[model samples]
Target: MHRRHFLLGGAAVMLLPVPAVADAAPRATLYKNPQCSCCEGYADYLRRNGFAVEVKPTNDLAEISRKAGVPEDLEGCHTTFIGRYVIDGHVPIDVVRKLLAEKPAIAGITLPGMPAGSPGMVGDKTEKFVIYAVTKDGKAPSVYATV
Candidate 1:
Protein backbone atom coordinates (compact mmCIF):
# COMPACT_ATOMS: atom_id res chain seq x y z
CA MET A 1 0.00 0.00 0.00
CA HIS A 2 2.92 2.41 0.81
CA ARG A 3 4.59 1.65 -2.55
CA ARG A 4 1.32 2.43 -4.34
CA HIS A 5 1.00 5.76 -2.52
CA PHE A 6 4.64 6.70 -3.36
CA LEU A 7 4.09 5.82 -7.03
CA LEU A 8 0.95 7.96 -7.16
CA GLY A 9 2.83 10.91 -5.60
CA GLY A 10 5.66 10.55 -8.08
CA ALA A 11 3.17 10.54 -10.98
CA ALA A 12 1.50 13.65 -9.63
CA VAL A 13 4.84 15.44 -9.42
CA MET A 14 5.69 14.42 -12.98
CA LEU A 15 2.39 15.82 -14.23
CA LEU A 16 3.11 19.31 -12.94
CA PRO A 17 3.87 21.84 -15.64
CA VAL A 18 7.48 23.09 -15.70
CA PRO A 19 8.05 26.81 -15.60
CA ALA A 20 9.49 28.51 -18.67
CA VAL A 21 13.09 29.68 -18.50
CA ALA A 22 13.35 33.45 -18.59
CA ASP A 23 16.33 33.51 -20.94
CA ALA A 24 15.52 30.51 -23.06
CA ALA A 25 16.50 32.45 -26.16
CA PRO A 26 17.95 35.90 -26.63
CA ARG A 27 16.03 38.58 -28.53
CA ALA A 28 17.45 39.83 -31.83
CA THR A 29 17.05 43.36 -33.14
CA LEU A 30 17.79 43.78 -36.86
CA TYR A 31 18.35 47.02 -38.72
CA LYS A 32 17.89 46.98 -42.46
CA ASN A 33 17.08 49.26 -45.35
CA PRO A 34 13.39 50.01 -45.55
CA GLN A 35 13.19 48.78 -49.16
CA CYS A 36 14.99 45.50 -48.62
CA SER A 37 12.69 42.50 -48.82
CA CYS A 38 15.49 40.03 -48.20
CA CYS A 39 16.00 41.49 -44.77
CA GLU A 40 12.38 40.79 -43.94
CA GLY A 41 12.84 37.24 -45.09
CA TYR A 42 15.80 36.92 -42.77
CA ALA A 43 13.74 38.24 -39.90
CA ASP A 44 11.11 35.61 -40.58
CA TYR A 45 13.78 32.95 -40.69
CA LEU A 46 14.99 34.03 -37.26
CA ARG A 47 11.45 33.92 -35.96
CA ARG A 48 11.04 30.38 -37.20
CA ASN A 49 14.18 29.39 -35.32
CA GLY A 50 12.79 30.30 -31.87
CA PHE A 51 14.45 33.72 -31.72
CA ALA A 52 12.34 36.72 -30.80
CA VAL A 53 13.23 39.13 -33.57
CA GLU A 54 12.51 42.83 -33.90
CA VAL A 55 13.09 44.47 -37.25
CA LYS A 56 13.88 48.14 -37.61
CA PRO A 57 13.83 49.65 -41.08
CA THR A 58 16.39 52.36 -41.69
CA ASN A 59 17.65 54.39 -44.61
CA ASP A 60 21.22 54.53 -43.37
CA LEU A 61 22.34 50.97 -42.76
CA ALA A 62 26.03 51.76 -43.13
CA GLU A 63 25.94 54.28 -40.31
CA ILE A 64 24.14 51.84 -38.06
CA SER A 65 26.63 49.09 -38.88
CA ARG A 66 29.55 51.38 -38.15
CA LYS A 67 28.07 52.48 -34.87
CA ALA A 68 27.41 48.86 -33.94
CA GLY A 69 31.15 48.04 -34.20
CA VAL A 70 30.90 46.04 -37.41
CA PRO A 71 34.07 46.29 -39.49
CA GLU A 72 33.55 48.34 -42.67
CA ASP A 73 34.81 45.65 -45.01
CA LEU A 74 32.71 42.98 -43.35
CA GLU A 75 29.46 44.89 -43.46
CA GLY A 76 26.38 43.18 -44.81
CA CYS A 77 22.96 44.27 -46.08
CA HIS A 78 21.52 44.15 -42.56
CA THR A 79 22.90 44.46 -39.06
CA THR A 80 21.52 42.82 -35.92
CA PHE A 81 22.17 42.76 -32.21
CA ILE A 82 21.60 39.74 -29.99
CA GLY A 83 22.64 40.50 -26.47
CA ARG A 84 26.13 42.01 -26.94
CA TYR A 85 26.89 40.35 -30.24
CA VAL A 86 26.22 41.84 -33.65
CA ILE A 87 24.98 39.63 -36.44
CA ASP A 88 25.66 40.90 -39.94
CA GLY A 89 24.00 39.92 -43.22
CA HIS A 90 22.23 36.68 -43.99
CA VAL A 91 24.29 34.39 -41.79
CA PRO A 92 23.03 30.84 -41.52
CA ILE A 93 20.74 30.17 -38.55
CA ASP A 94 22.82 27.19 -37.43
CA VAL A 95 25.95 29.34 -37.34
CA VAL A 96 24.09 31.99 -35.36
CA ARG A 97 22.94 29.37 -32.87
CA LYS A 98 26.53 28.20 -32.51
CA LEU A 99 27.67 31.77 -31.96
CA LEU A 100 25.19 32.23 -29.13
CA ALA A 101 26.17 28.94 -27.57
CA GLU A 102 29.90 29.70 -27.75
CA LYS A 103 29.57 33.33 -26.60
CA PRO A 104 32.90 34.41 -28.02
CA ALA A 105 34.64 37.57 -26.91
CA ILE A 106 34.13 39.58 -30.07
CA ALA A 107 32.17 42.54 -31.29
CA GLY A 108 30.03 40.42 -33.64
CA ILE A 109 29.97 38.08 -36.60
CA THR A 110 29.40 38.92 -40.28
CA LEU A 111 28.50 37.06 -43.44
CA PRO A 112 29.96 39.90 -45.50
CA GLY A 113 28.19 40.56 -48.82
CA MET A 114 24.68 39.27 -49.48
CA PRO A 115 25.62 35.87 -50.68
CA ALA A 116 23.09 33.96 -52.75
CA GLY A 117 21.35 31.01 -51.05
CA SER A 118 21.97 32.46 -47.62
CA PRO A 119 19.07 32.58 -45.18
CA GLY A 120 17.30 35.48 -46.88
CA MET A 121 19.13 36.03 -50.15
CA VAL A 122 17.78 33.97 -53.03
CA GLY A 123 20.20 32.33 -55.45
CA ASP A 124 22.28 29.27 -55.99
CA LYS A 125 25.15 28.81 -53.57
CA THR A 126 27.94 28.24 -56.04
CA GLU A 127 30.73 28.39 -53.53
CA LYS A 128 31.35 28.38 -49.82
CA PHE A 129 30.70 31.61 -47.96
CA VAL A 130 32.86 32.75 -45.07
CA ILE A 131 31.70 34.43 -41.85
CA TYR A 132 34.02 36.86 -40.06
CA ALA A 133 34.23 37.91 -36.45
CA VAL A 134 34.76 41.61 -35.89
CA THR A 135 36.77 42.89 -32.98
CA LYS A 136 35.29 45.19 -30.39
CA ASP A 137 37.56 48.04 -31.53
CA GLY A 138 36.39 47.64 -35.15
CA LYS A 139 39.78 46.92 -36.65
CA ALA A 140 40.40 43.78 -38.68
CA PRO A 141 37.96 40.89 -38.93
CA SER A 142 38.93 37.22 -38.59
CA VAL A 143 37.24 34.24 -40.21
CA TYR A 144 34.81 32.76 -37.68
CA ALA A 145 33.07 30.12 -39.76
CA THR A 146 32.32 28.95 -43.31
CA VAL A 147 29.02 27.79 -44.75
Candidate 2:
Protein backbone atom coordinates (compact mmCIF):
# COMPACT_ATOMS: atom_id res chain seq x y z
CA MET A 1 0.00 0.00 0.00
CA HIS A 2 2.88 2.38 0.84
CA ARG A 3 4.63 1.64 -2.48
CA ARG A 4 1.42 2.27 -4.41
CA HIS A 5 0.90 5.61 -2.64
CA PHE A 6 4.48 6.69 -3.42
CA LEU A 7 4.06 5.82 -7.09
CA LEU A 8 0.83 7.77 -7.23
CA GLY A 9 2.51 10.78 -5.66
CA GLY A 10 5.34 10.58 -8.18
CA ALA A 11 2.86 10.45 -11.03
CA ALA A 12 1.05 13.48 -9.66
CA VAL A 13 4.27 15.41 -9.43
CA MET A 14 5.16 14.52 -12.96
CA LEU A 15 1.81 15.76 -14.19
CA LEU A 16 2.40 19.24 -12.71
CA PRO A 17 2.75 22.01 -15.27
CA VAL A 18 6.25 23.19 -15.94
CA PRO A 19 6.92 26.89 -15.48
CA ALA A 20 7.82 28.88 -18.55
CA VAL A 21 11.26 30.39 -18.71
CA ALA A 22 11.42 34.08 -19.66
CA ASP A 23 13.25 34.96 -22.86
CA ALA A 24 16.29 36.95 -21.89
CA ALA A 25 17.37 37.92 -25.36
CA PRO A 26 16.27 41.42 -26.33
CA ARG A 27 15.53 42.72 -29.81
CA ALA A 28 17.94 45.36 -31.10
CA THR A 29 17.87 48.05 -33.74
CA LEU A 30 21.31 48.92 -35.10
CA TYR A 31 22.02 52.15 -36.92
CA LYS A 32 25.16 52.37 -39.01
CA ASN A 33 26.71 54.02 -42.04
CA PRO A 34 25.80 52.27 -45.25
CA GLN A 35 29.43 51.67 -46.19
CA CYS A 36 30.65 50.32 -42.84
CA SER A 37 31.27 46.56 -43.04
CA CYS A 38 32.30 46.40 -39.39
CA CYS A 39 28.81 47.48 -38.41
CA GLU A 40 27.37 44.51 -40.29
CA GLY A 41 29.80 42.23 -38.54
CA TYR A 42 28.67 43.58 -35.18
CA ALA A 43 25.07 42.94 -36.13
CA ASP A 44 25.99 39.38 -37.07
CA TYR A 45 27.62 38.90 -33.68
CA LEU A 46 24.46 40.10 -31.95
CA ARG A 47 22.36 37.73 -34.06
CA ARG A 48 24.58 34.80 -33.15
CA ASN A 49 24.12 35.63 -29.48
CA GLY A 50 20.30 35.17 -29.78
CA PHE A 51 19.45 38.86 -30.24
CA ALA A 52 17.05 39.77 -33.02
CA VAL A 53 18.91 42.55 -34.80
CA GLU A 54 17.47 44.99 -37.30
CA VAL A 55 20.14 46.76 -39.31
CA LYS A 56 19.35 50.26 -40.50
CA PRO A 57 21.78 51.70 -43.00
CA THR A 58 21.84 55.46 -42.74
CA ASN A 59 23.74 58.28 -44.35
CA ASP A 60 23.87 60.31 -41.15
CA LEU A 61 25.04 58.00 -38.40
CA ALA A 62 26.37 60.94 -36.44
CA GLU A 63 22.96 62.50 -36.27
CA ILE A 64 21.43 59.22 -35.24
CA SER A 65 24.03 58.77 -32.53
CA ARG A 66 23.47 62.28 -31.28
CA LYS A 67 19.71 61.86 -31.15
CA ALA A 68 20.13 58.59 -29.30
CA GLY A 69 22.01 60.39 -26.51
CA VAL A 70 25.50 59.04 -27.31
CA PRO A 71 28.19 61.34 -26.04
CA GLU A 72 30.39 62.97 -28.66
CA ASP A 73 33.66 61.50 -27.41
CA LEU A 74 32.24 58.03 -26.81
CA GLU A 75 30.56 57.54 -30.17
CA GLY A 76 31.33 54.43 -32.17
CA CYS A 77 30.91 53.49 -35.83
CA HIS A 78 27.56 51.93 -35.13
CA THR A 79 24.84 52.48 -32.54
CA THR A 80 22.36 49.92 -31.27
CA PHE A 81 19.19 50.28 -29.26
CA ILE A 82 18.16 47.36 -27.06
CA GLY A 83 15.16 47.69 -24.84
CA ARG A 84 15.44 51.20 -23.38
CA TYR A 85 19.23 51.27 -23.40
CA VAL A 86 21.51 52.39 -26.20
CA ILE A 87 24.67 50.41 -26.91
CA ASP A 88 27.42 52.18 -28.80
CA GLY A 89 30.22 50.63 -30.83
CA HIS A 90 31.46 47.04 -30.66
CA VAL A 91 30.38 46.05 -27.16
CA PRO A 92 30.93 42.42 -26.17
CA ILE A 93 28.03 40.01 -25.82
CA ASP A 94 28.79 39.17 -22.20
CA VAL A 95 28.65 42.84 -21.19
CA VAL A 96 25.43 43.33 -23.06
CA ARG A 97 23.89 40.36 -21.28
CA LYS A 98 25.00 41.68 -17.93
CA LEU A 99 23.52 45.11 -18.67
CA LEU A 100 20.18 43.60 -19.48
CA ALA A 101 20.21 41.39 -16.41
CA GLU A 102 21.21 44.16 -14.07
CA LYS A 103 18.80 46.76 -15.54
CA PRO A 104 20.75 49.76 -14.37
CA ALA A 105 19.28 53.26 -14.56
CA ILE A 106 21.54 54.57 -17.27
CA ALA A 107 20.92 55.98 -20.70
CA GLY A 108 23.24 53.41 -22.29
CA ILE A 109 26.75 51.96 -22.54
CA THR A 110 29.48 52.61 -25.08
CA LEU A 111 32.77 51.06 -26.15
CA PRO A 112 33.89 54.39 -27.64
CA GLY A 113 36.08 53.78 -30.67
CA MET A 114 36.52 50.70 -32.80
CA PRO A 115 39.04 48.68 -30.87
CA ALA A 116 41.16 46.13 -32.70
CA GLY A 117 39.83 43.09 -30.79
CA SER A 118 36.25 44.13 -30.16
CA PRO A 119 33.35 42.04 -31.44
CA GLY A 120 33.16 43.61 -34.90
CA MET A 121 36.81 44.56 -35.28
CA VAL A 122 39.08 41.70 -36.31
CA GLY A 123 42.51 41.29 -34.67
CA ASP A 124 44.05 40.52 -31.31
CA LYS A 125 43.34 42.58 -28.21
CA THR A 126 46.31 44.92 -28.40
CA GLU A 127 45.06 47.02 -25.53
CA LYS A 128 42.36 47.23 -22.92
CA PHE A 129 39.09 48.81 -24.04
CA VAL A 130 36.95 50.83 -21.66
CA ILE A 131 33.17 50.82 -21.89
CA TYR A 132 31.45 53.94 -20.67
CA ALA A 133 27.98 54.38 -19.28
CA VAL A 134 26.02 57.39 -20.49
CA THR A 135 23.98 58.98 -17.76
CA LYS A 136 20.25 59.51 -18.14
CA ASP A 137 20.70 63.25 -18.45
CA GLY A 138 23.29 62.86 -21.25
CA LYS A 139 25.98 64.32 -19.10
CA ALA A 140 29.56 63.09 -18.90
CA PRO A 141 30.05 59.37 -19.38
CA SER A 142 31.82 57.23 -16.80
CA VAL A 143 33.67 53.91 -17.09
CA TYR A 144 31.22 51.07 -16.86
CA ALA A 145 33.32 48.09 -17.86
CA THR A 146 36.81 47.28 -19.11
CA VAL A 147 37.62 44.53 -21.57
Candidate 3:
Protein backbone atom coordinates (compact mmCIF):
# COMPACT_ATOMS: atom_id res chain seq x y z
CA MET A 1 0.00 0.00 0.00
CA HIS A 2 1.15 3.57 -0.62
CA ARG A 3 2.60 5.35 2.49
CA ARG A 4 0.01 8.15 2.27
CA HIS A 5 -2.87 5.65 2.00
CA PHE A 6 -1.46 3.56 4.90
CA LEU A 7 -1.16 6.63 7.12
CA LEU A 8 -4.72 7.68 6.34
CA GLY A 9 -6.01 4.18 7.10
CA GLY A 10 -4.11 4.09 10.42
CA ALA A 11 -5.57 7.44 11.41
CA ALA A 12 -9.09 6.24 10.55
CA VAL A 13 -8.55 3.08 12.61
CA MET A 14 -7.43 5.16 15.60
CA LEU A 15 -10.61 7.26 15.38
CA LEU A 16 -12.92 4.23 15.24
CA PRO A 17 -14.77 3.56 18.47
CA VAL A 18 -14.34 0.13 20.06
CA PRO A 19 -17.36 -1.22 21.95
CA ALA A 20 -15.23 -3.01 24.51
CA VAL A 21 -13.09 0.00 25.28
CA ALA A 22 -12.78 0.81 29.00
CA ASP A 23 -14.75 4.02 28.48
CA ALA A 24 -17.79 2.05 27.32
CA ALA A 25 -20.40 1.77 30.06
CA PRO A 26 -22.20 -1.39 31.03
CA ARG A 27 -25.92 -1.60 31.73
CA ALA A 28 -27.17 -1.62 35.35
CA THR A 29 -30.31 -2.88 37.07
CA LEU A 30 -31.37 -0.58 39.89
CA TYR A 31 -33.93 -1.66 42.51
CA LYS A 32 -35.72 0.86 44.68
CA ASN A 33 -39.16 1.84 45.98
CA PRO A 34 -41.49 3.65 43.58
CA GLN A 35 -41.94 6.75 45.71
CA CYS A 36 -38.30 7.33 46.50
CA SER A 37 -37.27 10.58 44.86
CA CYS A 38 -33.60 10.30 45.75
CA CYS A 39 -33.38 6.87 44.22
CA GLU A 40 -34.90 8.18 40.99
CA GLY A 41 -32.37 10.98 40.99
CA TYR A 42 -29.55 8.49 41.36
CA ALA A 43 -30.89 6.53 38.41
CA ASP A 44 -30.87 9.70 36.34
CA TYR A 45 -27.25 10.30 37.29
CA LEU A 46 -26.34 6.84 36.07
CA ARG A 47 -28.27 7.37 32.85
CA ARG A 48 -26.49 10.66 32.20
CA ASN A 49 -23.15 8.92 32.56
CA GLY A 50 -24.01 6.42 29.78
CA PHE A 51 -25.32 3.60 31.97
CA ALA A 52 -28.27 1.71 30.57
CA VAL A 53 -30.42 1.56 33.71
CA GLU A 54 -33.23 -0.91 34.37
CA VAL A 55 -35.24 0.42 37.26
CA LYS A 56 -37.34 -1.96 39.34
CA PRO A 57 -39.51 -0.16 41.84
CA THR A 58 -40.63 -2.06 44.88
CA ASN A 59 -41.11 -1.52 48.61
CA ASP A 60 -39.48 -4.82 49.48
CA LEU A 61 -35.93 -3.52 49.52
CA ALA A 62 -34.75 -6.03 52.11
CA GLU A 63 -35.80 -8.94 49.96
CA ILE A 64 -34.08 -7.46 46.95
CA SER A 65 -30.82 -6.98 48.82
CA ARG A 66 -31.07 -10.40 50.39
CA LYS A 67 -31.58 -12.11 47.07
CA ALA A 68 -28.72 -10.15 45.52
CA GLY A 69 -26.39 -11.25 48.37
CA VAL A 70 -25.94 -7.71 49.68
CA PRO A 71 -24.73 -7.72 53.27
CA GLU A 72 -26.84 -6.14 56.00
CA ASP A 73 -24.21 -3.66 57.10
CA LEU A 74 -23.65 -2.39 53.60
CA GLU A 75 -27.31 -1.77 52.97
CA GLY A 76 -28.34 1.43 51.27
CA CYS A 77 -31.49 3.14 50.00
CA HIS A 78 -31.03 1.92 46.44
CA THR A 79 -29.42 -1.33 45.32
CA THR A 80 -28.09 -1.91 41.82
CA PHE A 81 -26.66 -4.79 39.89
CA ILE A 82 -24.08 -4.13 37.19
CA GLY A 83 -23.12 -7.46 35.76
CA ARG A 84 -21.59 -9.36 38.70
CA TYR A 85 -21.05 -6.26 40.76
CA VAL A 86 -23.64 -4.86 43.20
CA ILE A 87 -23.63 -1.12 43.65
CA ASP A 88 -25.21 0.18 46.88
CA GLY A 89 -26.50 3.65 47.65
CA HIS A 90 -25.58 6.76 45.70
CA VAL A 91 -22.22 5.80 44.22
CA PRO A 92 -20.55 8.06 41.71
CA ILE A 93 -20.83 7.07 38.04
CA ASP A 94 -17.09 7.28 37.52
CA VAL A 95 -16.47 4.85 40.35
CA VAL A 96 -19.11 2.45 39.05
CA ARG A 97 -17.59 2.64 35.56
CA LYS A 98 -14.17 1.90 37.03
CA LEU A 99 -15.54 -1.10 38.88
CA LEU A 100 -17.07 -2.55 35.73
CA ALA A 101 -13.99 -1.80 33.64
CA GLU A 102 -11.68 -3.43 36.16
CA LYS A 103 -14.00 -6.40 36.84
CA PRO A 104 -12.75 -6.99 40.37
CA ALA A 105 -13.34 -10.34 42.07
CA ILE A 106 -15.32 -8.85 44.93
CA ALA A 107 -19.08 -9.26 45.33
CA GLY A 108 -19.81 -5.55 44.95
CA ILE A 109 -19.30 -1.91 45.88
CA THR A 110 -21.25 -0.23 48.72
CA LEU A 111 -21.65 3.29 50.03
CA PRO A 112 -23.71 2.07 53.00
CA GLY A 113 -26.32 4.58 54.20
CA MET A 114 -27.63 7.63 52.35
CA PRO A 115 -24.63 9.82 52.97
CA ALA A 116 -25.24 13.54 52.65
CA GLY A 117 -22.49 13.96 50.10
CA SER A 118 -23.25 10.92 47.98
CA PRO A 119 -24.11 11.52 44.33
CA GLY A 120 -27.90 11.59 44.70
CA MET A 121 -27.77 12.68 48.32
CA VAL A 122 -25.82 15.84 47.61
CA GLY A 123 -26.45 18.15 50.55
CA ASP A 124 -24.84 21.39 51.70
CA LYS A 125 -21.23 20.34 51.14
CA THR A 126 -19.32 17.43 49.73
CA GLU A 127 -18.05 15.06 52.36
CA LYS A 128 -15.29 12.54 51.86
CA PHE A 129 -16.42 8.92 51.91
CA VAL A 130 -15.26 5.49 50.89
CA ILE A 131 -17.02 2.89 48.78
CA TYR A 132 -16.22 -0.61 50.02
CA ALA A 133 -15.88 -3.86 48.18
CA VAL A 134 -17.97 -6.39 50.08
CA THR A 135 -16.42 -9.81 49.96
CA LYS A 136 -18.59 -12.81 49.12
CA ASP A 137 -18.49 -14.10 52.67
CA GLY A 138 -19.83 -10.78 54.06
CA LYS A 139 -16.75 -9.75 56.00
CA ALA A 140 -15.26 -6.32 56.63
CA PRO A 141 -15.15 -4.84 53.17
CA SER A 142 -12.03 -3.43 51.54
CA VAL A 143 -11.98 0.10 50.16
CA TYR A 144 -12.97 0.29 46.52
CA ALA A 145 -12.78 4.08 46.07
CA THR A 146 -12.73 7.26 48.14
CA VAL A 147 -14.81 10.29 47.21
Candidate 4:
Protein backbone atom coordinates (compact mmCIF):
# COMPACT_ATOMS: atom_id res chain seq x y z
CA MET A 1 0.00 0.00 0.00
CA HIS A 2 1.10 3.61 -0.65
CA ARG A 3 2.57 5.41 2.42
CA ARG A 4 -0.35 7.88 2.64
CA HIS A 5 -2.93 5.07 2.38
CA PHE A 6 -1.09 3.02 5.00
CA LEU A 7 -0.96 6.03 7.38
CA LEU A 8 -4.69 6.63 6.84
CA GLY A 9 -5.46 3.00 7.64
CA GLY A 10 -3.39 3.22 10.82
CA ALA A 11 -5.18 6.38 11.88
CA ALA A 12 -8.56 4.71 11.27
CA VAL A 13 -7.51 1.76 13.42
CA MET A 14 -6.43 4.14 16.17
CA LEU A 15 -9.82 5.84 16.03
CA LEU A 16 -11.66 2.56 16.58
CA PRO A 17 -13.00 2.20 20.08
CA VAL A 18 -10.86 0.30 22.52
CA PRO A 19 -12.02 -1.54 25.63
CA ALA A 20 -13.35 0.82 28.26
CA VAL A 21 -10.58 1.78 30.66
CA ALA A 22 -11.08 0.60 34.22
CA ASP A 23 -10.04 3.91 35.64
CA ALA A 24 -10.29 7.31 33.99
CA ALA A 25 -11.58 10.02 36.30
CA PRO A 26 -10.43 13.51 37.12
CA ARG A 27 -9.07 14.21 40.60
CA ALA A 28 -10.34 16.68 43.19
CA THR A 29 -8.84 18.56 46.09
CA LEU A 30 -10.18 18.14 49.64
CA TYR A 31 -9.58 20.69 52.38
CA LYS A 32 -10.27 19.96 56.03
CA ASN A 33 -8.84 20.35 59.49
CA PRO A 34 -5.86 18.14 60.23
CA GLN A 35 -7.46 16.69 63.38
CA CYS A 36 -10.61 15.29 61.77
CA SER A 37 -10.59 11.55 61.05
CA CYS A 38 -13.97 11.43 59.38
CA CYS A 39 -12.70 13.79 56.73
CA GLU A 40 -9.99 11.25 55.94
CA GLY A 41 -12.63 8.57 55.48
CA TYR A 42 -14.50 10.82 53.08
CA ALA A 43 -11.30 11.23 51.12
CA ASP A 44 -10.93 7.46 50.97
CA TYR A 45 -14.43 7.22 49.54
CA LEU A 46 -13.41 9.59 46.81
CA ARG A 47 -10.34 7.51 46.08
CA ARG A 48 -12.41 4.33 45.65
CA ASN A 49 -14.49 6.08 43.03
CA GLY A 50 -11.45 6.67 40.77
CA PHE A 51 -10.75 10.18 42.00
CA ALA A 52 -7.18 11.08 42.79
CA VAL A 53 -7.34 13.47 45.73
CA GLU A 54 -5.14 16.03 47.41
CA VAL A 55 -5.94 16.42 51.08
CA LYS A 56 -5.08 19.83 52.46
CA PRO A 57 -4.64 20.03 56.19
CA THR A 58 -5.69 23.26 57.79
CA ASN A 59 -6.22 24.35 61.36
CA ASP A 60 -8.42 27.30 60.58
CA LEU A 61 -11.16 25.50 58.70
CA ALA A 62 -13.61 28.35 59.07
CA GLU A 63 -11.37 30.74 57.22
CA ILE A 64 -10.87 28.26 54.44
CA SER A 65 -14.60 27.61 54.16
CA ARG A 66 -15.35 31.29 54.13
CA LYS A 67 -12.92 31.89 51.29
CA ALA A 68 -14.32 28.91 49.38
CA GLY A 69 -17.89 30.30 49.69
CA VAL A 70 -19.27 27.44 51.79
CA PRO A 71 -22.29 28.71 53.67
CA GLU A 72 -22.19 28.80 57.46
CA ASP A 73 -25.31 26.71 57.96
CA LEU A 74 -24.03 24.14 55.49
CA GLU A 75 -20.57 23.86 57.04
CA GLY A 76 -19.32 20.35 57.56
CA CYS A 77 -16.11 18.59 58.56
CA HIS A 78 -14.71 18.62 55.06
CA THR A 79 -14.71 20.86 52.02
CA THR A 80 -13.87 19.66 48.53
CA PHE A 81 -13.49 21.57 45.29
CA ILE A 82 -14.27 19.92 41.99
CA GLY A 83 -14.06 22.44 39.23
CA ARG A 84 -16.11 25.41 40.39
CA TYR A 85 -18.32 23.56 42.89
CA VAL A 86 -17.54 23.14 46.59
CA ILE A 87 -18.65 19.95 48.31
CA ASP A 88 -18.99 19.97 52.09
CA GLY A 89 -19.02 17.24 54.73
CA HIS A 90 -19.63 13.52 54.25
CA VAL A 91 -21.28 13.81 50.85
CA PRO A 92 -21.19 10.64 48.80
CA ILE A 93 -18.64 10.49 46.01
CA ASP A 94 -21.34 9.52 43.55
CA VAL A 95 -23.23 12.72 44.35
CA VAL A 96 -20.06 14.77 43.87
CA ARG A 97 -19.47 13.10 40.53
CA LYS A 98 -23.09 13.79 39.58
CA LEU A 99 -22.79 17.47 40.40
CA LEU A 100 -19.53 17.73 38.47
CA ALA A 101 -21.01 16.01 35.43
CA GLU A 102 -24.29 17.91 35.46
CA LYS A 103 -22.79 21.35 36.20
CA PRO A 104 -25.95 22.53 37.94
CA ALA A 105 -26.77 26.16 38.58
CA ILE A 106 -26.37 25.76 42.35
CA ALA A 107 -23.17 26.65 44.10
CA GLY A 108 -22.48 23.40 45.90
CA ILE A 109 -23.71 20.50 48.08
CA THR A 110 -23.34 19.92 51.83
CA LEU A 111 -24.07 17.06 54.25
CA PRO A 112 -23.77 19.27 57.36
CA GLY A 113 -22.26 18.42 60.75
CA MET A 114 -20.90 14.95 61.43
CA PRO A 115 -24.00 13.02 60.56
CA ALA A 116 -23.63 9.35 61.27
CA GLY A 117 -23.80 6.82 58.38
CA SER A 118 -22.49 9.41 55.98
CA PRO A 119 -19.52 8.46 53.82
CA GLY A 120 -17.08 9.39 56.56
CA MET A 121 -19.42 8.81 59.50
CA VAL A 122 -20.23 5.19 58.83
CA GLY A 123 -21.34 3.36 61.93
CA ASP A 124 -24.26 1.32 63.33
CA LYS A 125 -26.00 4.11 65.18
CA THR A 126 -26.49 6.36 62.21
CA GLU A 127 -28.48 9.56 62.37
CA LYS A 128 -30.56 10.68 59.44
CA PHE A 129 -29.46 13.89 57.78
CA VAL A 130 -30.16 16.12 54.82
CA ILE A 131 -27.80 17.44 52.19
CA TYR A 132 -28.32 20.99 51.01
CA ALA A 133 -27.54 22.84 47.82
CA VAL A 134 -26.03 26.18 48.82
CA THR A 135 -26.11 29.05 46.40
CA LYS A 136 -23.40 31.62 45.83
CA ASP A 137 -24.97 34.37 47.92
CA GLY A 138 -25.23 32.18 51.05
CA LYS A 139 -29.00 31.93 50.91
CA ALA A 140 -31.19 29.21 52.38
CA PRO A 141 -30.30 25.85 50.93
CA SER A 142 -32.74 23.69 49.04
CA VAL A 143 -32.69 20.00 49.86
CA TYR A 144 -30.36 18.26 47.47
CA ALA A 145 -29.99 14.78 49.02
CA THR A 146 -31.66 13.32 52.11
CA VAL A 147 -30.69 10.34 54.19
- Top candidate on TM-score is 1
lDDT of 4 by residue, 1-147 (tens): 599999999999999988655436566889888888888998988888787788999887887666766777669998888778888888876677778888889878888788777787767645556778888775777988666
TM-score of each: 0.82, 0.81, 0.76, 0.80
Q: Model 4 clash pairs?
A: none
Candidates, ranked, TM-score: 1, 2, 4, 3
Clashing pairs in 2: none
Clashes of 3: 0
RMSD to native for every prediction?
3.4, 4.0, 4.8, 3.7
Error of 3 at 75 (Å): 0.9
Q: lDDT for every model?
A: 0.88, 0.88, 0.82, 0.80
Model 2 worst lDDT run, 10 consecutive residues: 17-26
**Model 1 TM:** 0.82
TM-score, candidate 3, is: 0.76
Give the true-structure RMSD of model 2.
4.0
Candidate 2 lDDT over 58-139, as tens digits, reads: 9988887777778788898899999999999999998998899899988889998899989989999998889988875847
Cα lDDT tens digits for candidate 1, 1-147: 999999999999999988676357568999999989999999999988888888999998998888777867889989999888989999998889889889998888999888889898898998898999887774678899988
